[model samples]
Target chain A: MIRFDQVSKRYPGSDEALRNVSFEIAQGELAFVTGHSGAGKSTLLKLMAAIERPSAGTVLIGNQNVSKLRPRIVPYMRRKFGLVFQDHKLLYDRNCFENVALPLYINGVTGQEAAKRIRAALDKVGLLGKEKAMPITLSGGEQQRLAIARAVVSRPAILIADEPTGNLDETYAAEIMALFHAFRQVGVTVIIATHDAHGISNIPGKMLHLDHGRLTVS
Target chain B: MKHWINQHTLVWRLVLARTCRNKLATLLIWTVIGIALCLPALLYVIIDNLNQLAGEVKHEPQISIFMKLDADKTIVDTTKSRLEKHAGIGSLQFVSKDSAWKQMQDDALTDNIATNLKQNPLPDAFFIQPKDHAPTAIEQLQHELQNWEGIEHVLADADWAKRLYSILELGKKAVWVLSGLLGFALVTIIGNTIRLQILTQREEIEVSKLIGATDGFIRRPFLYAGALYGFGGSLVALALINGIITIFNLSVADLAELYGSSFILALPGWQISLGITACAVTLGWLGSYIAVNRSLARLNPH
Candidate 1:
């Protein structure tokens, strides 16, 4: 679960990207942040990730104020949440398996355990056969799935995706959402920040809308 | 311990693998380092040769002769020849009153009492050149020169040579210190480079962190990259130094032949190479640690 209390983010040489925004995401809940471009969707996501700090108020991730946490402890906080950007942000040079296995390797989960879990994540994303395939070779949908598999491979409790389905076709967008929904069903929280009405319309979850840096429940 | 080292080894492999992939970049960096490193190597050779030159000079006779103001030209000229035949004399010269006037004119301390003189008033003297310039040998030669009847004073010229030898010693010390500083700068350059790469891959880093990757695990490859750069640069620098040494040997050989000495320009002996390798490894390790620490700090998972 994550909570933002009166959080605001101001960029250098620009107006506030977000202002006094407050929201709470429930455990195991799948939700969407709906807004047009520059509606503070990305800022909210970055704040949640603690990549950027709030200008005002607190960002609480699992009862810890991530914004107030020491700089050295940020990696530990980051380990608890799997984040995906709109671009999939895959290391294009690496194959799907290595990408997925990166977190495991970082965490020192190597040998048979690493192999088993990597296979499991790849299998879960239906990328089992594409383990050795580079992200460039995978179709748009498969790349998004691979990103999601990478996100969940280490079993982070919270998954934050910034427009994971943005470049995907409708069919694949729904399929990716379905994957997020499956993860949500198993008690993992999901936050997807996107502007697509079609993408989140059928998803059964709360929809938080942002307009001019203000977040309001719709 | 074995498992820990194995894990570390894995990180090393990852760093080295990334370095291998960017061979061109690695080569360019190595070249930069090679150029920086070669300065000290060349200096080392110069200093070593100076040491050898000093050793050769130690065998030459050195004596100083004081003058007598009232000494007759005839007696001084006769005394000079007699001193030349002295047992330890390899060579000898007389500093006549006229020659002394010429030296004072060359020194040209204007507005002095010497400028008021019509006739040169300086005394005639003998400058003894001994068979051996070594301190003990020169001392013995000085004693012999002192016993000569017309020799007003006999001394050894210790001040100037000792001053120059001390300066060369300082130059030798500077080489070590300069090399250490340059090595540190290399680490920082490599560190900052790796840190920028990590920052550019922030999302990937965050994703990896969330997957429970330890900071060390994530940093392995960058560290390896640093080490690879350092090690490769050393080799290139060594090669450059060798090439320069080869070019230098032609004239060095000619001059050394004149001096009856043979010298070769070479890398610091094997132990020194070991030191170089250690420095390269340490720099890489430190660089990667710094890069990983800062990047991982900014990456938030929870």
Candidate 2:
């Protein structure tokens, strides 16, 4: 579903962030992107999402050369994936249900269909009873689950979780990884960026470890 | 298409929703915008009324063509005939020298006979009412009448009208300039308000962008908020102008009565509505767009 053919990324500071990076994830594969801080894990995901362009080589998502995709189609391309972040990027003004409903809402789902989807997503994260609770009121783990629910409500073809369990306890982090495994079981491609070896190392999945800025796939 | 409209609808919906949630800030912002918008709109209406009043006065005043005392009776009769036949004369009356003297005698009786004499000095006159009586109109007619044959002088009672009209014109122009400056102030006020809002939402914007929400999605509501600033401000201004007119209408009527005339206050018409609405929408759209785009650009979603 995603292919980075010898991709390289450079930021405006004249510093090379990603150099000669190459990777491929077959459809429905579950994988971990393991790296230390600033090891290009975030940069690779950003390139795949077309947030930042590669300085050299091409990045392909769904067989389309997103490297050459015009500016306008970028948003449409993004609608195909779910993204979870370590920060639980939920709107503070909105309740848990509303935050989870956002992706589907942007996709033009409404009325009975949207409510039903939001309930199911929230329910999957074990947050069914807390729909009306505001993000500011939720615990850290609950907020993380809400962000995950928001990501998966649209059932996007690919899931990119950037340290989705970064700030959680080992118990909560494993729970989050189990949810990602459930998605992979349903044939959705999943790639998680994290250094949580203590919590997620025992889980069965391909691990792509990065040192400096180059990936070592195993 | 319904799809496109829904996408765009988020901008407006979010604005209103946020306003409802955060009423105090929204209200304060709207009030600032209203004050700015109201000044210009009120001036525009007053200037319009001034123009109308000027038009009315232009069609009401007349001049008199006084014949020379040395001129013959035949010349006076011929002059009266020429004045009567002229296009400039809305109406003309041949006031014989005797009647002119009688009018002076009657006026003198009201005063004292001792001061009345002075040799029945009034001359035979042709009272020429021009087609238009505005200050400028009468002045033009005065020059044309002076060139007529057998007439020694042409004088129109238009000095005060000319001075008042010119003064009012200048006042109207001043109002226009003041309103324009106020319009700029309104834009700046709303732009600054939006800028602050952008600053407050910086973290939320970074989250949205990082999650793949496009810049347009994040900006939709802000644009709507800016539009509402202008729209709400305009409506407030409309109310303000109406209130001012209501409070001053009776006094204005009383002032006009001093001139032996009645005056009425008129409500604004469709023109004012169109002008205010257009000004509001333009300001709102531009202000929000600028604030949203700049802030969003600075936010690195990654």
Candidate 3:
């Protein structure tokens, strides 16, 4: 579960990124936070993962107060959810299988057990046959799929994707949205931040809209 | 225990993967580190061998006292008694002038010459072995003997030993200085290599951090790489030194044979080899640790 009550984030020598934002998404719920550029969607997700502490109020992931969590515990806390980026942040030097295995490797699961999980995750995203292919060699859609496989490889409780389909075409964006829908059906809480509200509107999910650092609608 | 093993095994795998990724760079770094470490270690081995060789050339401190031929038996007896009472004397052999003349007459070349001489030219001498072989002790004994009654001269044949000892002392100091400088060079070499490695893996580190990888997890591979550098360098240094020593021994073998010396060069003992390897590995690990921590601190993942 993710909860944000009166959460605000401000950068030094700049205006506030998020102002008095309040929202809660229960376990297994799928939601989208949409706004224009510089609308603090990325900051809101960062607060959930404890990447950036809220300037005021509380951001709670489960029962833990993420804003006040110890620095040493931040990494462990992040393991509860997977994060995806717009650029597909896959390590280009390694093959697709290695990239997907990153989370499992970090979690100390390896050999046959890790291989099984990695293969299963890749198979779900239709990248099972391209396991040996390098990221640079993959198409734009396949790369985004590979990133999705990596995010769910560890079976994280929550999935937070920041503009994951920004670089893909209309068809690939719909495919990514369908993948998120399928993950929610399996009890994985999913939250996505994107500026293209209309593209994802056709999918059935709660929508939280933001405008100029203020939460305008939920 | 199981968790510990799994963690270490994964780290080692990562290290191997990265090392294999850039074979040329790894080899270059290892070679540079090996050369830096080899200089000091080579000097140490050479100094140790030289000291051992010098040790084999044993020289005992002995003072030879010459007495005047006209000295009376009474004065000679008194001088002998005084020497016998002295604590510095280990043993003394008194060779009388008549016996010295007789011994010279026994020789084939001096027999007829000694028979034609009316008086014996040889003087009574005492071969005095000192209790202590220290240079200062022997010098003190020689000075004390020169002031004794009926003694004309006291000669201590230990100048060569003194010079050799002084040279060995200077060599020890020189090895220390050289070792210190080379040690600093090794640390720098390892540190710079680790820094470059950190730069190359910057994105990987950032991604790992975001994906819930701890600082320890991100640093594990770099630490292993550093230790491997030190470990590999020490091995290469050892091999290089042994090869050079073998060649040196081959060239010097004939010279030693000409001198009729059974001396052969000795390789460093196992303990010393292990010590050098351990020292190098520790330095490498420390350098990598410092570099990785500094870079990690500078990166703000958020």
Candidate 4:
């Protein structure tokens, strides 16, 4: 479970990124954070992942106060969430299997066991056959799917994506959303940030809409 | 424990793969480090060999104790017995005044000078070889002999050996100073290499951190790379030193033959070789640790 009580984030020489935001999502629930560009959606997700601390608030992931967590423990705490960046963030130098193996390797999983899980995750993203192909050679949609495979490879309890389908076509975006749906069906909590309302209209999930660093609707 | 080992194994494999990817650059770095380290190591080997040569040249230092001219046979006998009883004296030969005077007369150069003397003016003497060849020990023995009864003077011509010892001491110190400076240079070289590696892989590191990779995880491969570079460089240095020694020995053999002596340069002992390797590896690890930590702190500013 994730909870945020009056969380606020401010950057120096800039206005507040998140203003007294409060929200909660139950475990195993799929939620969408909908907002325009620069609206606090990414900041909220960052706060949830403990990548950035809230300026003033209590952001709790499960029972841990992520805002006050010690710097040394931040990495271990981050292991709870699988993050997919807007640009895929896949390591282009390595092949598809290696990119997907990153999270598992971070978690001390390797050898045959890691290979098994990596293949399964890649298979879920429809990238099972291109395990040895380089990311630079892959199509944009394939790259996005590879990123998703990497995100879920470690079987993180919470999956967080920042505009994961931002550059994808409608067909690829729908396919990506279906992967999230499948993950949600298996009790993996999924959180996606996007401004594409029509693409997510048919999907049934809780929506948190943000406007100008304030949560407008939940 | 199995998982921990597996993790390290995986990181090692990754580091090796990455290192092999840039083969020429890695080799160049190793060569630079090797040359830096070889300077000091070669100096050490030469100094060590010189010390062995000095030890071989001077088997033992001897002290000559001369008796007073008025001292008689009983005094000579007593002095000889005392010298023999002394723990510091390894061996002693007593030369009576009469025999010394006769030996002087028997010598062609000193015979004429000795015949001019009316009586045997030579004093009885005891030639003593000290058990300890150290300059200080020999000087101490000479000092003790000087205070003995009926002894006119004690003379020890250990000045040449003493001078050699001091020079060797200075050489050893120079080796130490050079090693320290080169060790620091090696650390800096390795640190810069790792820093560049981090820069080239900045995107990978950033993405790894975002996906829950610990700083340790990101640093592991770089650290291993540094250690490997250090290890490889040390090996090259060792090989370089050995090759030089071999070449030097060939000429040394001809020179020794001309001198009617047999001398060969000895290779560095296993301990020194092991020490060099260990020192290099530790420096490599330290270099990478410092570089990676600095970069990580900057990348993830609090």
Candidate 5:
């Protein structure tokens, strides 16, 4: 479960990125944050992941006040959410397996147990066959899937994505959406930020729309 | 506990892999650290040996008190009693003027001069071994005895020992100063090396942080790498010092033989070798800790 209560964020020397935004999503729900460019979608996702604190108001996840969390506790707090970046953020020098193993390693999981979970996550993303292939050698869609595998390898309760399919074609984007749908079906709350409205029109889920840093509809 | 050990083992493996990946750079760093440590180690060894030799030579400093020629038997008896009661005098032996002349005449080296002397000109003397071997202590005793009744002069044969002790003291101080400077240099070298490593691995660090890696987790590998470098460097330094000592001992043996002595340079014992290794490892750890913490703060300014 995630909730933002009248949250406002403003960067120094820049206009407000998000102003007085509030929303709530129940457990095991799939939600889409729809907005145009510079519409505060990434900023909202970052706040939920505790990567950035809100300038005003509180962001809560599962009864924990993320805005009030100490800096020392931020990393442990972040472990609760799986984050997929628009750039994929995959280390290209390593093979797909190592890329996915990053989250597990950070969580202090290793040995055959980590290997088993990594393989399971890769199998979920249909990247099981390319575990040893380097990320740079994979196709764009495969690389994105690899990133998704890395995100979910730690079995986080909530999944947050900042434009998960911004660089993918429609077919790849649909496949990525289906992966989120599957995660939601298994009791993992999923929140994706994207400017593309038509991409999620057929998928039954809650939609929160933003325009010019203001939440217009929910 | 098992998980903690697993994590450390994983990080250590990663450090080893990275070190192997940059063999030339690692070797160069080790060599630099080795030479830096070796300089002070060699100096300490030489100074330690000299200190041992000085200890042997200055075991019991002696003072000779010669009585005035005109002093009578009663004067000699009074001086002997005073010396016997003195706490600073360990032991003493009296040689009367008549026996001294007789012994001189009996000796082959001094018989010619002794036979020509019409009267016995030797003065009564007390050969006193001081309780303390310290040069200053022996000199103080000599001064105290020289002012005694019927005593002509007091001679303490500790001047050469004092000079050697002063030189050895200076050498010890030099070794300490040199070790301090080189220790600082090693820290800087290791710090700079770790900084470069952090810079090159900037991308990996960023990605790791983004995915919930703790600062400690990220710092573990670099710390291990720095410690390994230090460990390797200390080994090289010990080897170099041992080799040099061996080579020098070969020549030292011949030189000692020429001087009718068997003194040879001894390698530093286990305690000292372990101490050097521990110091080097700590410095390496400190250097990498500072480097990684600084860069991590900059990278994640939350």
Candidate 6:
């Protein structure tokens, strides 16, 4: 569960990115945050992960106030969520297997056990066959899938994505949404920040709309 | 237990991977550290040897205290008793004028002088040995004996020891100053190298931080890499010193013969070697810590 109560985030020398935005996503629910560019969608997700602190707010995940979490505690707080970026953020030098195994490796999983879990995650994302292939060689859609595998490898309770299908075609974007639905079916709380609301209008999920740093609809 | 081992192994593997990624650059950095550390290490070895040489010189220190020519048997008796009670005089043998004259006749160069002199010109003297032959102790003893009654002069063959000791003192100070300078240089070298590594791996580091990798976890591999560089460099420096000692050992025979000594150049003792290694590794760790922490602070993941 995630809650944002009157959370406002302001960068130094700039206006608030999120102005007193408040919303809540219940346990095991999937929600899409729809907003125009510069409408505080990315800032909202960043606040949830404690990546950016709210200038004035109380952002809560479960029972913990993540907005007030210390820097040392931020990483442990992040372990609760699986985060995917629009750019994929995959290491180009490493093969698909290494990139997908990043989360598990960070959690001290290795050897045959780590390998098995890494394979399972890759299989879930349909990237098992491309384990040895480099990210640069993978298509945009496949690269996005690889990033998803990396995110879910640690089996985080919450899954958050910023523009999960930003660079993909309609078919690929639909497929990516389907992947989110599959995880949501298994009781994973999934929240995605996207500019295109029409892309996910047919999907069954709550939609939180943002306009000019304010929560227009939830 | 299994998890702990796995974690350590993963970090070590990553460290090696990163190090091998830029092999030439790593080698260059390590080479620079090795050379930087080698100078102080070599100086330490030299100082150790000099101390040993000084020890050898300690055993050979001799002094002769000459009595005034006009002093009578009472003066000789009083002087002998006074010297016998002196703390610095380890052993003493009285040399009468008759024996001094006879000793000159035994030597080919001084035989004619013994016969040419009508009376014994050599005064009564005490062939004295000090408790310690260190320059300061010998000089203090000389100064103390100069004011003794019926004493004409107190002479010691300690000029060479004094000069060598003075040089060794200067050398010790130089070693300290050099160690400080080289310590700074080593820290700078390792810090700059780690900074470059952080810059190159900024993307990986940022992504790692985002995906639940703690700052400590991200820092582990880089710290190990820096430690490896320092540790490996120190080992190289030790090898350089030992190699120099080996070369010097081979050539020291002629020099030892010239000095009537059989002393050979010795490798630094285990303590000194361990000290150098410890210093180098600590510097490496410290340098990496500073660089990593500074860069990490600049990168705001939140």
Task: Report the lDDT tens digits of candidate 4 across residue range B17-109.
Answer: 888899999999989988998899999999998899998766457788899999778877888888888898888988888899889999997
Predict model 4's lDDT versus the native. Answer: 0.90
Worst 10 residues of 3 chain B by lDDT: B54-63
lDDT of 3 by residue, A59-177 (tens): 88999998777888889999998898767789998999999989998888877888999999999999999999999999999998999999999999999999988877899899988
- Model 5 sits at an interface RMSD, in angstroms, of 1.0
At residue B301, what lDDT does model 3 achieve? Answer: 58
* Candidate 1 regions with alpha-carbon error over 4 angstroms: A198-201, B1-7, B22-32, B52-149, B152-220, B239-267, B276-302
TM-score for predicted model 5 compared with the true structure: 0.88
Taking chain A of model 5 alone, its TM-score versus the true chain A equals 0.99
* Residue range with the least summed lDDT across 10 consecutive positions in model 2 chain A: A104-113
Candidate 1: tens digits of C-alpha lDDT, residues A1-218: 78889888888899999988988888988889999999999989888877778888999988999778886677677778887878877888679888888777665577678889999999998999999888999888888899888888889888999988898888898888888989989999999998897777877997889998998774
Per-prediction TM-score to the true structure, in the order listed: 0.71, 0.84, 0.88, 0.85, 0.88, 0.89
Question: After superposing candidate 2, which stretches have Cα over 4 Å from the reference?
Answer: B1-13, B59-63, B68-75, B78-122, B127-153, B156-172, B300-302
Winner by lDDT? 5
Assess candidate 2 and give its TM-score to the true structure.
0.84
Stretches of candidate 4 exceeding 4 Å from the true structure: B56-93, B96-156
How large is the i-RMS for each model, in angstroms? 4.2, 2.9, 1.6, 1.1, 1.0, 1.3
Residue-level lDDT of model 6, residues B184-235, one tens digit each, is 9998889889999899889899999888899888898888888998998898
- How far residue B69's Cα lies from its native spot in candidate 6, in Å, is 8.6
Q: Residue A72 lDDT in model 1?
A: 66
Question: What interface RMSD, in Å and to 1 decimal, does model 6 have?
Answer: 1.3
Which portions of model 3 miss their true places by more than 4 Å?
B1-7, B56-64, B68-75, B86-141, B157-163, B254-259, B300-302
For residues B62-108, what per-residue lDDT tens digits would candidate 5 score against the true structure?
Answer: 78889999999999998899889999889999999989988999999
Considering every candidate listed, which one attains the maximal DockQ? Answer: 6
Candidate 6 chain B, which ten residues in sequence have the lowest lDDT sum?
Answer: B52-61
lDDT of 4 by residue, A1-218 (tens): 99989989998889999998999999999999999999988888888898899899899999899978888889899889989888888888889999999989889998999999999999999889999999999999899999989988988899999998898899999999999999999999999999898999999999999999999888
Task: Give residue B171's error in model 4 in angstroms.
Answer: 1.1
The parts of candidate 5 lying over 4 Å away from their true place are B59-61, B66-91, B95-125, B129-154
Candidate ranking (DockQ, best to worst)? 6, 5, 3, 4, 2, 1
DockQ of each: 0.20, 0.46, 0.68, 0.68, 0.71, 0.77
Q: Share of real interface contacts recovered by each model? A: 0.38, 0.29, 0.69, 0.69, 0.67, 0.83
